[model samples]
Target: MDRPVSKVREAKLELYRKKGNIHAKEVTGRFNTLRWGMVWLTQTIFYGLCWINWESAGSVRQAVLFDIAHEKLYLFGLVLWPQDALLLALVLIIAATALFLVTALAGRLFCGFACPQTVYTSIFTWIEARIEGDHLARLRLDAGPMSLRKLLIKTAKHSLWAIVAIWTAVTFVGYFTPIRELLPTVVALKTGPWEAFWLIFYAAFTYVQAGLAREAVCQHMCPYSRFQGVMFDPATSNVAYDRQRGEPRSNRRQAGQTGDCIDCGICVQVCPTGIDIRDGLQYQCINCGLCIDACDQVMEKIGAPLGLIRFASETALVAPEKHRPWYTRPRIGAYAALLLIFCGMGVWTLEHRSLLLVDVLRDRGALLRETAEGEIENAYTLKLMNLSEVPRDFIVRVAGMPGARIVGEERFTAEPGSIRPVSVTVAAPSDSSLSGIQPMLFSIQAADDRSIEVVEKSSFILP
Candidate 1:
């Protein structure tokens, strides 16, 4: 005879081992339709934007290009220099705030619908289903012995996956390079070393990640799933298995004796991450709600109430408590406020952006020199960067002194998207009693657009 505690521990160990693995069947529902819609919308925008070219002032480039090599970002009519990296930082913060707001309000809508991993995996699985058949047939095919049909099916599935992976890779690299040029080079097998390497690398990554790894990426690879717990509270609604009404579970058809759940395991079958929802909220759960769809279908077949598995808060299901609406949630409200503030700042920055930038550096080696005309002169270097798409002729002026003026010319022309560094001399009348190192402003105004002006302050030294 075995000791009672030892037998109980052994039984628990066996149960834990069994519980660790779950094979979820694919499911279709309203949420699934919405998810696929997002997939199409996002992928379409990503691919379409790559091919768009915008022509400005005789220079043509991709409408939205992040030219890392040139340290310049081009967005349609806007050009962002390296100094404007703060805008990128603000954009990231805004995105993070948006994610937080959505998570607090609805749950992991990002993970479920819009995440690349989920979307790509959904596509890969759809292709697999087309080639391999339904869930039962797929399982059977995998279990069956080696055959010509199996090999053909596998070959066809993998070939389609490879094509999609390659296309995805090309579109990704298109953000940095001109897509029209890159495509021809790729087709002719004349792509440069780095481009070819990245194309192959990204394609292989997509193929392996989406087709082979699948849910493992969501469960073990992604850090989002791990940190998602930090965003959750008792009121956070998640896809849950209502254990109160679901358990003392059995497969029998007894009336009113057991709870509604038939122990059909449809919820477990439809889960992509292979985690049983009935076991309680686990870290592996993406809150996709596929289990709800599967459970609802089962409930309908057995003439029971729907929503055996549904989106509900732990507080709502377990304890009798009134949960506040989304807008009332303190964390969500705070995130929303921050998002609005940053968005306003970004808009203001764009609105007040100048078309030209000027930097005036005084020649420290030799300051003030007496000219042959009996006037005190200062030598300075002016770096004028044209930020606009069109060619600009700027009328440069010097201010802060009564008789101060530029030596030779007042206007200079700058080509579109180019920087011009010109040496300039400023002269002051000898009789004028100007002090040593007096403050002066160098202002540049565009001839075409009077609203676009940039000013830099420098010291005017006298001998």
Candidate 2:
């Protein structure tokens, strides 16, 4: 049976509404140069950090490896365990708060410059431009009929994009798996299931998102672009056109034209999201300032003053007297304060965190027992997790009850980044009148390091 007409019509409408071919024309400016510089710096650190090795706990491992199988994260001199998960949470909060602060001060700064989507899209587009020529050339090529030259260009562009995407995926997964060992398996086509799965999945996603989807990810997929308006205030710095000065626009310079705008349309050509800035700030605008750069170039050539389109606050544009410095804005100040607080807490927690952690669980199967020597005994399990990088012997001692002592083992050793479960028995005189349950303290201290210790509380039951 033929497909339903309604379904086909809906599909056609959806495609037409959502799709727009954006071939952002290349422009040379300080902001564009800075964006490219960030791309180079970030990718260099990402792709290179996995291969860098550091001496860690008598063995060489990746400088920044998240060894999930061992429940350890080796970050240069610092080691993190599952117990330190709070630190990770705090770090995430700090990052998110910082993003909010930046967004409040300058609209979508992260989205425009530092976002992975923007960075990778810029790279893919750069490669595409190199292969297919500039904006006009690319448009012409797409509009023309298929030819051998077009086929060669398209094939070469996709092949290079795949190479970069696959490498990016491998480097990302290398943070979890040992890249040194995983590389050999990848080369031999014998990677484990999870490794192969993530590698292929991420590579395909990068190619599709960066090379094919492009601006659609920033426009529709990213929630930040949609909600950034909530963070925006009148004081937020954004790329805006001076409508009062530039309006009454004309394509040609009449004899008595007053407005500065010449209707050149260069700004729209250079926009990554393909939005006209003159229509005012839109959700699709990334605030990358490329339009400002394009407009400034046109103004300079026409002997007109710069800043016809530039970064300025809405309040400054409307009432210049009400304008204030970015830091003086109450919203920006609040977000900055939150970001600092989160960062400070994370640093303080990491500094004062104990190197040893202990958890005591009283044996419920046989809570209390009478010994032949007329003594009351209790069994407990102590879980000693070492959060340090070096192995050490720990001494377990029980207190808070007179004449109470550990019966069997008091000295135990824990390897680096390992959790050891120690079974212990505490015995006290049966006729001591200590009936019911009594609170006791179990202290585990490192044999060599006095600074490393943990105290846990448990109950001593007597019959």
Per-model tally of clashing residue pairs: 3, 0
Give one digit per residue, the lDDT tens place, for model 1 in 209-294: 99988888888999988888888888888888888888767666577777888766667667788767888888778777788888
User: Where does model 1 exceed 4 Å of error?
Assistant: 1-24, 58-60, 253-255, 431-433
- Write one digit per residue (lDDT tens) for candidate 2, span 81-145: 88889999998999989888888888888888889999999999999999999987887777778
- Per-candidate TM vs. native? 0.92, 0.92
The lDDT values for all models are 0.82, 0.87
Evaluate residue 429 in candidate 2 and report its C-alpha lDDT on the 0 to 100 scale: 89
